[model samples]
Target: MSNVVVQPTGITAADVLAVARGTAKVVLDPATVAAMATSRAIVDRIEAAGRPVYGVSTGFGALANTFVAPERRAELQHALIRSHAAGVGAPMPREVVRAMMLLRVRSLALGRSGVRPLLAEALVDLLNHDVTPWVPEHGSLGASGDLAPLAHCALVLLGEGWVLGPAGERVPAAEALRGAGLTPVALAAKEGLALINGTDGMLGMLLLAIHDAAHLFTMADVTAALAIEAMLGSERPFLPELHAIRPHPGQAVSAANIHRLLQHSAVMDSHRDDLAHAVQDAYSMRCAPQVAGAARDTLAFVEQVAARELVSVVDNPVVLPDGRVESTGNFHGAPLGFAADFLAIAAAEVGAIAERRVDRLLDVTRSRDLPAFLSPDAGVNSGLMIAQYTAAGIVAENRRLAAPASVDSLPTSGMQEDHVSMGWAATRKLRTVLDNLTSLLAVELLAAVRGLQLRAPLTPSPAGRAAVAALRDAAGEPGPDVFLAPVMEAAREVVRDPALRTAIEREVGTLG
Candidate 1:
């Protein structure tokens, strides 16, 4: 995976995603290895000189003032790993564990954490061989850098934890390492603290969430376009000139996307000259860009935070070039916590608005002349009536999950860590929000396409036609109500498919 020479500083979010989700390999720069050695030399010097460093010599957190004797130093590191590996919920997913491991390796590769190059290599080796450590879902206060979760990971490095087997079974870490032909690393001065002290877990989740949200947000725009045509709403509201006056970059991008999708629509043109239609549509259809655009802009902010975090060296008592090791509060997760919480709010609002559009598409009173709930026979079939309830239920859950986790902090580590960032919780709930949004958008896609299909002989635009046809190919043409769960799930799969985006782009050029 090395191109010419690999540098730790230029690693991308895509790189993180690759390592997290696929079989991508990591190649450390030789210079980075050399730099890590230099950093380790500083730690070695401090250990030899018998100086009382926070991580290298003295006890941790509330026990910071208690210094361990030389004989107990190694034991100090081991006990740290064992005691902190106290996470008690279900094990995290393999991908999340992989991402956390890769990110932790990236932090150490930066050479500021004073860990041996061998330790970083061991983590890389585990990643390349897929020896994912079993990390649990609970226990990170999001302070002191996702301590419990990282400790569970670090435990594998010491040959004392469990790893997920190839078939997703739990196996002993020692046995897994042996099967992979690797040895457990001995924790040295400052190494244990270095291993566990970073926001990699939460940061990894945030990065993955942002990646998914980008797709969902774009799909939201696509479904919104389909809904507008289905509702016989005017596309004039998405005019670039209208958005230019109140120029929000995300708004412009979303407006441009919807505008592109609505190009040459027979349904839109059918009503363009008709005096019988309402002058403007409801806010859900008219303000699609504003809501989704704000979410896009929020996602951009979260991306910025993730970008900065991807390269950050987040260990406390970090090594400096001039041979000074000083304690710093760099490990706090407040920034990521706030970013994740903000994104949750934005995602919830997007789902909320999309839910409204789905409801309008199903309501006889609101769907213009479309059949009630878009059923072929309104009274004989309940149609997508319950599907709207499903969307509404998800929206309600998202609203509750949207309550900011960052603002709900609690003290831990005996008040030594009095302030904490509930970042892990924020990122965890953000994942659920995105997942629910996917289903909500799927429901909208089903309703919108059904509405467009009923507009029948009138036909959707070229882009809208492509979206409708692509989904119909998967879920079948809408008609009398059949079992909708299977159809709804299929719609979600279509929404998730990259090919759906490709198909839409083939018809309407590239969307913003």
Candidate 2:
């Protein structure tokens, strides 16, 4: 966590995930109050000296050169929020909102956004108490720092918005603040612009994608192992010395992970001398590490970008060394915009391979000893046959969405805000890919576990049986063709349970 402090605002990736999942509290440092005071002081000095400052005296966006009268200063601040709360489409998930609020709070704590201590605290309170602003999901160029959605967030601070109470009632902002014993936050100096300008929303989404994809990465490795079990394919490819000669850290990690996954399986030992295993496995199964490892490397970089973003003040009019604020393009999200799309592609490929393995398991000829469609009574009970089809359909849809959103940009905001980073869409797409991939892997896990269970007397490798046991805890063995919805739900539940994941790790040891 301290590493996050020296690098960012001292908030780690683990912190955001905990907050996003509603399991932690948000507390800013006392020094953060001091930081806010300093930032606000710089703005006060500029105003007292009668020097023109951007966002303080000057207008915004197309109206930047126009000066605001002292009489309308408060009006201007409120107007900035009101005018920009034009977000459309679905409401953002509360977890994402909480993450955005915490992200913004940390950015302000860096002493750069010119917000006061209370205004920053209001954001922190929302995260802590779960009084999240009902920010709309759509309407962000991802350049100009996610204007519309963030404006809705700022509106809540100004005592104007729809807020969800802890009991799930939607209350008007004015009463909500009063009922919660919280005061309405007034934007002073650059606070209005700061509150509504930044990629916290996008950053929150990116952080979620990074975190969820990381868990899914481990899941994918396990899913591949299950596929190998079902296919009764070669395990020699995972030999440590083979990958040692030309080691990529990721390749070495994956080989070791898969090797341990199959370690004590009687099935693999049975195939030890088969020339067919040497002839090779399918590209999807054989090249699992190569394809999945690249995704892992991509994730390493994405994690750094997201962690840096927590402390980054991605808004206009940065406070410079001499207290002169020059409006820079820090708000433009090209860096993370491209990263979100790249991650989408990576996550999509994860689903792609997982679905193929699902296909391999379904094919009677390919899945030796396993009944076709994993059905004991094939024609009478449609056991898991359509489940593979569903997984395939979602995987194909993921491919279509994987087509980079960054590659297609449209001019907006009267051409002033042209070349939008559609980074919001990319972030959302990565989120979608994560959801699809998890559910797809769920199906593959179910089928593989079922296939391994069929060969009862012969125990699977130690790691394989442990992986199966983890599944058994969540879902008992399928006795016959039962309603698949429960099975799918159970599948998703296992993929999500942190305890089950730890159990698998303990049994299998270190994985890629």
Candidate 3:
């Protein structure tokens, strides 16, 4: 793909992903550069006149009243970056740092942060050359932007911190800059604050999580369909007419996906006329759409929040086109915080429901005659009983993680930043929840596919068969249990594999 030309108002979630994944390059639009120069001129006029600006001549936060001499103005910007670059713990993933860099550049390119075009271009150069800063996972309260984390990012531009080279080795920022044929730029008035004061860290993680969650939501439906067919459950509950009366768009989409996946199934037809079969399946089977669909709807709302954030100027002291510099609470991360926490709740519930289905599939009593844990050699081999335990453990952890981090706030910066969003913490945990959900769904898919394989001469729907075939191709057929960890891990990989979804789609067409 060609480099993504970032216009002030047109950065999308996809653009962020492309840059994060290293598939596309980024360039600031010429018009954006011109606007930024205009903003920078306003800052220079203010500084030259020795007029007090919040982040220019005056101190930050509670220190806003303190005045500084003209000679010390550049030192103030540099000091702010060095003092705030105090994040601790393990570094954030390289992809996340790349997204943060891309977003910070995008925010500056909007022409409201009063940063020179050179600073913004330097950020773009860092990304384009693949020199990722090693930002720690902690330090931001998510109130005054992702201060510490973003400072770690800005440290690299000043040739002070460490960066991951293109070959994935850690090197000094100076070395990385020299290798990339780039030089560090000096910080001007309010430029350091502009770089660090925003919700870019949390927002970056949120965007990436949103992207992954979109796919996982669909994968949840696909795996649930396999479980339903594997257990001989009726597809009648998923019929469009049955869902039309309720009329939730997400529910309807999920139901339609399930219906399509089970079309013309010999396994389902075999039980169609049996009165001895239970009149209806359990909630895990019958209510799969309701649970998974709620997640889908939650994702849609999160996407809307993310989309608005993409175009927003989240700086602290924003420079307006009319030349007014105002200190505002636009830097607070409450918006992203709430969205991340909300999505974590939705994701945990999705995994919880999938775990229940996995439990049912393993229990001989509840599974409608599938062998205990799908084990042909019952007593001698434990089969997939432990896999349910693993999923259950992860589901329990997810429940704990679902508690809203946004609600837990503590005072900082001498009570000036007393109420923080804790949004960075929220988004961090959301990434974990997503990872757990992926593994949990993989476990459910593995057990369900095994149950389907045991069903023998009765064929699943063409879509269902295609899904099973995809899993078998990736992990081989399930049989008398051997070392199952490798198989389960392989199954997890298959769940994440796009090809598996594509193969199923070729048979049943597109799913929701």
Q: What TM-score would each prediction reach against the true structure?
A: 0.98, 0.94, 0.98
**How many steric overlaps are in each model, in order?**
0, 3, 0
Candidate 2's residue-wise lDDT over 1-512, tens digit each? Answer: 22122122546667777788756777777777887787778887776776667788777887777888766766788899999998876678888887777777777777777767888778877666567887877888787878888888888888898776666556798887777787787666677888877787888899888878888888788878877876787877878898788677666777777778887778877777866554778878887877777788888888888877766778678765467777878787777888998888888887788888888877888776678887777878777898988998998899998898876788876677778787787887889888988898899888888777776666786656765787785556645687688878888877766655576678777665
- TM-score of structure candidate 3: 0.98
Residue 438 alpha-carbon offset, candidate 2, angstroms:
0.5
lDDT of each: 0.89, 0.78, 0.90
* Candidate 1 local lDDT, 310-355, one digit each (tens): 8788889899989999898888999999999999999999999999
Worst 10 residues of 1 by lDDT: 1-10
Which residue pairs show backbone clashes in model 2?
5-10, 264-461, 265-461
Candidate maximizing lDDT: 3
As a TM-score, model 2 comes out at: 0.94
Question: Clashes in model 3: which pairs?
Answer: none
How far off is residue 78 in model 1, in Å?
1.1
Error of 1 at 136 (Å): 0.6
RMSD of each: 1.4, 2.5, 1.2
